[model samples]
Target: GAGVSQSPSNKVTEKGKDVELRCDPISGHTALYWYRQSLGQGLEFLIYFQGNSAPDKSGLPSDRFSAERTGGSVSTLTIQRTQQEDSAVYLCASSLGPGVVYGYTFGSGTRLTVV
Candidate 1:
């Protein structure tokens, strides 16, 4: 019944620091995705998890970024050595499947600011 939830609607960190963003997906949904949107840019898919396995991690930007999903429901995205360019909104979404046949429900997102 729940949608997706992300913590720290806004995060401001000094450069070279580390931050962790959390996501809680709806119950029974087997698919969870992480995406980031930079100013005036399209949503970039960072990683995806189906159940307890992650099938895609191609868009993580750099080795400084990583993520993990546990119990097939909750996910956490961590960014290490933050840079000013890393400032963006990290969004999380879950779907019935890849297509979301109906529509995709997105979290309000955690806005990160690396100063």
Candidate 2:
């Protein structure tokens, strides 16, 4: 794709359910990131994948949240045992590399609501 693309723009899931969010980044991008923004809060980093290197999972809020980038182009973020506090807009961004120089192209985001 020419730009970052995310599926299921809006998701409504019940408590304890699991949700999978997908992201397709621009071609040739080497870095993909997942973040989430809660109501009235700043974007919180979730996970990062760069090339074939091991992903930096330090930012994941909990074990229930995980992500992976495959073949360096597509990525998926999975949230398990969803909770009300997990409601937020999950954003995916991709860059040519892992620094400020390359900048980033972000997807519209998937709004997750837990009830």
Candidate 3:
């Protein structure tokens, strides 16, 4: 079983541009999550998907940030309009289920830098 992996690991864009971050989660895992972590702010859950359904979208900062899970495995996060305020580590994680009691693994993250 492979671990969750993220692409680019770093992204630099200008204000109002768009960016996409990719994630490949471990095989057989049914739950996936996206989070944002700023310099001082710790990990903040962005969205969570169980199987093919996203039950929570409360953490998404704005319309600019969105994500989707495919076939209950791979996932991609898209930022419609990148802003300096959107600069942060976009982290991806996967687990066996939805609850956070345990069993989640995180990717190194795609660091988005809006310049």
Candidate 4:
């Protein structure tokens, strides 16, 4: 893809249901990231995958949130036992590398609503 792509732009899931959000990053980008944004809130880093390096999972709010990148091109964010608090816009971004200098390309995001 020319830019980051995310699936299911909108999702409404019942509480306790699990959901998977996908992301296809731009070609040649080695740095991919997942973020969660509450209404009118700043992005909260969720996870980061850079090349073959170990992913940084520290940002995940809990074990129920996880993500992975495959073949260095696509990524998926999975949320288990969804709660109302989990309702937010999940954004995916990619860059040439990690750092502010590289900037980032973000997807429109998947708006998740857990009721």
Q: What TM-score against the true fold does each predicted structure earn?
A: 0.94, 0.94, 0.93, 0.95
RMSD (Cα, Å) of candidate 4? 1.2
User: Which residue pairs overlap in candidate 1's backbone?
Assistant: none
Worst 10 residues of 1 by lDDT: 96-105
| TM-score for candidate 3 | 0.93
lDDT of 1 by residue, 13-84 (tens): 999999999999888778899999998899998998888788899988999999999998899999999999
Per-residue lDDT for 1-115 in model 3, tens only? 4789999899999998989999898898899999999978999989989987899989998988888888988898999878899999989999988675777898889999999
Cα deviation in Å at residue 55, candidate 3?
A: 0.6
What would the per-residue lDDT of candidate 2 be over residues 42-78, giving only the tens digit for each residue?
A: 9998888897554588889889988877787888899
Q: Candidate 2: worst 10 consecutive residues by lDDT?
A: 51-60
Task: For residue 30, give model 2's deviation from the true position in Å.
Answer: 0.7
- Candidate 3 — which pairs collide? none
lDDT of 1 at 49: 88
lDDT tens digits, residue span 68-90, model 4: 88898889899999999999999
Query: With candidate 1 superimposed using the best TM-score fit, by how many Å does residue 61's alpha carbon deviate from the native?
Result: 0.7
The lDDT for every candidate, in the order shown, is: 0.90, 0.90, 0.89, 0.91
- Candidate 4 — worst ten consecutive residues by lDDT sum? 50-59
Clashes, model 4:
0
Using alpha carbons, what is the TM-score of model 1? Answer: 0.94
